[model samples]
Target: MEAVDVIEVSREAIWVALKVGGPALVIALVIGLVISLFQALTQMQEMTLSFVPKILALFLALMGLAPFMLTVLSEFTVTLMDRIVALG
Candidate 1:
């Protein structure tokens, strides 16, 4: 592929990555911030406390968004395959 084609593919890959990751990332960020605030107020500086909630929140977020993520990934895969087929 030419440079432009490579750039376009890379950009699409990044976009797909962002879409797949954005929800979990946002959820983790929010959970971490809230936990941080709670810890600050209560003076309970247990590092593990922050981790479990963040992980759980991220897991739940991922589960909830799985279908949409799958759809995006599948679409990307199909498009990539079609491009390969066309080139071949």
Candidate 2:
């Protein structure tokens, strides 16, 4: 493949990764922030307090978003394969 084709594929790959990961990441961020606030308010500074909520939130987020994520990943994979075939 040409350099531009490589770059295009790489960019698409990155975008697909970001799309797939974005929901869980965003959910974790929000959960972490809320947990931080709660810990601050309660003056309970336990480092381990962060993981459980974030993990649970991420799991739920992933479950909720799985279908959409799958669609995005599948579309990207198909598009990339098609591009590769066309280039070949």
Candidate 3:
């Protein structure tokens, strides 16, 4: 409830967000870079060429990593709930 508590909570929330999302973000970044390179090499600038693969890869990655992501988010939620109870 104090400024320090708020800052701590905010920092934790950001960390949890990153933990949950970082994998997908990394996958997307790598996929995008690879696709860009391929496009550059092949001289194929089709819009779908870049977007479709990234979307599919991201979806597959999210599916594959769902359990880990769920565990992290659940742990963070439990931590937040504990803090809320303590505050109350």
Candidate 4:
């Protein structure tokens, strides 16, 4: 493939990756921030306190978002396959 084609594919891959993973990441971030604030206010500095909630939140977010993520990934895969066929 040409350089431009390669760059475009790489950019698209990264975008797809971010889009697929963004929701869980965002959920985790929010949970972590909230837990941090609570810890700060209550002065409860248990290191493991933050992990379980974040993990659960992230799991729920991922489960909720799985269909959307699958659609995005499938679309990206189709587009990529089309591009490959066009290249060939």
Candidate 5:
């Protein structure tokens, strides 16, 4: 494949990765921020406090978003396969 083809595939892979990961990451970030605010307000500085909610939130988000994530990844995979076929 040409350099342009490789670059296109790489760019697509990165975009797909970001699309798939972005929601969970965003969820986690928001949860963590809220939790931090809670902790600050309550003056309850517990390490586990930060982790438990973030984990649970991320888990729930992943569960909710799994189908969308799967579809995105699969579509990217199909695109890659089509490119491979075209190349060969």
Candidate 6:
């Protein structure tokens, strides 16, 4: 493949990765921030307190977003395959 084609594929790969992972990451960050604030206010320093809720929140977010994520990934895959076919 040409350099331009390679760059375009790389860019699309990065975009797809961010699109797939961004929501869960954002949810986790928000949950962590809220838990940190609560801990600060209440002075509760139990490590598990922060860990468990974040895991649960992330899990729920992932589950809720699974279908959308799959659709995005499948579309990316199809487009990538089409590009490969065109190149060949």
Candidate 6 clashing pairs?
none
Quality of model 2 by C-alpha lDDT: 0.89
What are the clash counts of all predictions, listed in order?
A: 0, 0, 0, 0, 0, 0
Task: Give me the runs in candidate 6 sitting further than 4 Å from their true place.
Answer: none
How would you encode candidate 1's per-residue C-alpha lDDT over 1-88 as one tens digit per residue? 7888889999999999999988888888899999999999999999999999999888888888999999999999999999888887
| lDDT: the better of candidates 1 and 3 | 3
Instruction: For candidate 3, give the lDDT of residue 40.
Output: 99
Candidate 2 Cα misplacement greater than 4 A, ranges: none
Q: Between candidates 4 and 5, which one is better according to lDDT?
A: 5
Residue range 1-88, candidate 3, lDDT tens digits: 9999999989999998999899999999999999999999999999999999999999999999999999999998999899999987
lDDT of 2 by residue, 17-85 (tens): 999997788888899999999999999999889888898878888888999999999999899889878
Would you list the clashing residue pairs of candidate 5?
none
Cα lDDT of candidate 3 equals 0.95
Residues 1-88 of candidate 6 have per-residue lDDT tens digits of 8999999999999999999999999999999999999999999999999999999999899999999999999999999999989987
Off by over 4 Å in 5: none
Model 4 ranges with Cα > 4 A deviation: none
- Candidate 4, residues 1-88, lDDT tens digits: the string is 9999999999999999999988788889899999999999999999889999998898888889999999999999999999989987
Better of 5 and 6 by TM-score: 5
Between the candidate structures 3 and 5, which one is better when assessed by TM-score?
5
RMSD of each: 0.8, 1.2, 0.8, 0.9, 0.6, 0.6
Q: Candidate 5 at 80: error in angstroms?
A: 0.3
Worst 10 residues of 5 by lDDT: 79-88
Report the candidate with higher lDDT, 1 versus 2.
1
Measured against the true structure, the TM-scores of the candidates, in listed sequence, are: 0.94, 0.91, 0.95, 0.94, 0.97, 0.97
Candidate 3 vs. true structure, TM-score: 0.95
Estimate, for each residue in 4-37, the C-alpha lDDT of model 5 and write its tens digit: 9999999999999999999999999999999999
- True-structure lDDT of candidate 5: 0.96
